[model samples]
Target: MKKLVLTGAAGRLGSYLREPLTKMCDELVSTDRVDDIGTLYPGESYVQADLSSLDAMLEVIKGADMVVHFGAIGDEAPWDDILQSNIIGAYNVWEAAYRCGVKRVVYASSVHAVGMHLKTDTIGLDAPHRPDTYYGLAKCFCEDLASLYWDKRGVESVCMRIFSCAQATNARSIGTWLSYDDLIHLVERSIDSPVVGFTVVYGISNNDRAVVDNSKAGHLGYRPKDNAEVFAKAVFADTPPLDNKDLANLCIGGPFATVELGNSGVAALGVVDDRKET
Candidate 1:
């Protein structure tokens, strides 16, 4: 592609994607709310832009061939905050992509969109929205937004419902983990695929204990290489047995399902800040 725009360039997941994205396009424009993201790759540039502002989104996405949208308040927060950054931000992204004629948007959606479902249910791509928190609710809105844009505006999108994209430190992560290597592969497939009108794929590794199913999205060619079962022994040995009564242990959303509406679910997950350095 000639140009690729990546939002949330300063975030943990965005940091890991910057260097690799540079190689895919002639120019990679990385944008975020931060003033700077330290260093950039050879063909990459940084643009400081807020997700809530439609003008800002338009300016940053103006000449992009495709957009990898990861910019948002990643954790649960107050209603107003979720409305501005996640909901409105999502609308701005799709609108900008429509206006600017961008081909596809690879969104970083979360599993919390269906967090209330039982872990044993094995959620598919067609699962109905059952958000656990305000943050999760925002994700549900964006997924629908992606669908609407595709159906009405001819803008393609792939909403990847990512689970835990960190190390398998907790027992829940053993079933939800998405390794960095696998993440890169998934993003690559989402970008390089020939045609995808409107798709929803679970961003998970090849874990034996995974509760989500991706059989429906096989056309995207996202074959995960890492498995969380490798950490099964240590995680199980360190953590206590699951209590089925606890929502965190019983639901697919893990800690997110148990947190208060406006509280931060990430804080409860105890996820390590192991972002890759650029």
Candidate 2:
């Protein structure tokens, strides 16, 4: 592809993706709300743009072959904030991508979309949306929007239901951790895979305790190479016994499944910062 656009370039996950994405195309346009994203890779350009502004999104994504849409409120929050930054933001991104003649959109959907489902159930790619918060609801909307766009406008999409793309820092992460390498693998597969009209894949590593199944999305050829089992012993030792009555302990969304609508679930997850330095 000659051009690739990535929204949320200043975010933690986006930061890790920039360098590799830069290498994938002739020009990689990275956009975010910040004035700049510190530094740019060799074939990379930064454009400060708001996700909620359709015009801004369209301007940044014009003439792109694909869009990697990781931009959004990363946690549960007030309804108004989530509405603008996540819900409206996603619509603008998809609309802009479609207008720009972009072939595909790789969205960063979350496990919270099905957070209310029990972890023991081992939900599949076809699992119904049961959002645990306003943030999760936004993800469900994105997936549905993707489906609509694919069916009507011939745009391809991959709604990756990311499950804790952080270091295995807790008992929940032992089952949910998605290593940085695995994340890059997932994104690359989402981009490179042919004939992916509209797909949903679980963005999890090859963990022994994985709660989501991606077998249905095997056509994408995503094979995760990392696992969280190495940290399982330490995680279990540091964590307390799971509360049977706690929504976080019983559900796939973990803390997100338990937080109030107007609150944040991030504070509850003890994440060790493994963000890329580059």
Candidate 3:
């Protein structure tokens, strides 16, 4: 690719992608609302823009071969905030990509889209959307948006239902943790795949106790190498026993399924690094 655009370049996940994406193209246009992203990689550049503004997003992503749309509020919040950042923001990205003639869009979807389901069921990409919160609902909307764009507009998309891309700090991480290396691998496979019209793959590592089934999305060639089992003992050592009555412990969505709407579900489960660390 000659040019690639990456949204949410200032985000922690984005931090891991910057250098790699910069190498994938001649120019990597990294955009965020921040004035700057501290330091830029060799072929990377930053643009301060909001996702809710279609015009601004179009300007930043236009003339790019593909877009990695990692931009969005990554946690549960008020419906008003989720509407602007994730819902409207998704439309803007897809519409902008369409107008810009970008070939593919890589989205940062979440496991919360199917969070209400039982973890023991081994749900697949074909599983119905059972969003636990407004945040997860936004992910479902975007996944559907991608499908619509593919059927009507010929724009391809890969909605990665990322489980958890942080360190294995808890028992749940044993099954859901996706290392930074695996995250990069997943994204690379999503980008390099030959045919992915509207693919939906779970973003997880090869954990011994994983609950998700990515068999249908194997065409993407995302063969995870890392295993969360390496941290199983360490995590289980300090983690408390699972409570059958607690939605946070029993359901796949964890605390997200237990939290009240318009509240911070992510806060209820202090798992990932919330700070925008680079």
Per lDDT, the best of the predicted structures is 1
TM-score of each: 0.99, 0.98, 0.97
Candidate 2 residues 1-278, lDDT tens each?
99999988888999999999987899999999988788689999999999999999989999999999999899999999999999899999889988889999999999989999999999998889999999899899999999999999989999999999987889999899999999999999999997799999999999999998889999999999888999999879988888899888999999888787879998899776666665
State each candidate's clash count.
0, 0, 0
lDDT of each: 0.93, 0.91, 0.90
Colliding pairs, model 3 = none
Task: Give me candidate 2's TM-score against the actual structure.
Answer: 0.98
Candidate 2: segments with Cα more than 4 A from true spot:
none
Q: After superposition, how far is residue 78 of candidate 1 from its true place, in Å?
A: 0.7
lDDT of 1 at 192: 98
lDDT accuracy of residue 183 in candidate 3: 93
Candidate order (lDDT): 1, 2, 3
Q: How high is the lDDT of residue 47 in model 1?
A: 92
Least well predicted 10-residue stretch by lDDT in candidate 1: 269-278
lDDT tens digits by residue: candidate 1, 53-96: 99999999999999999999999999999999999998999999
Task: List model 3 lDDT by residue over 102-174, tens digit each.
Answer: 9999999999999999888989888999999999999999999999999999999999999888778888888
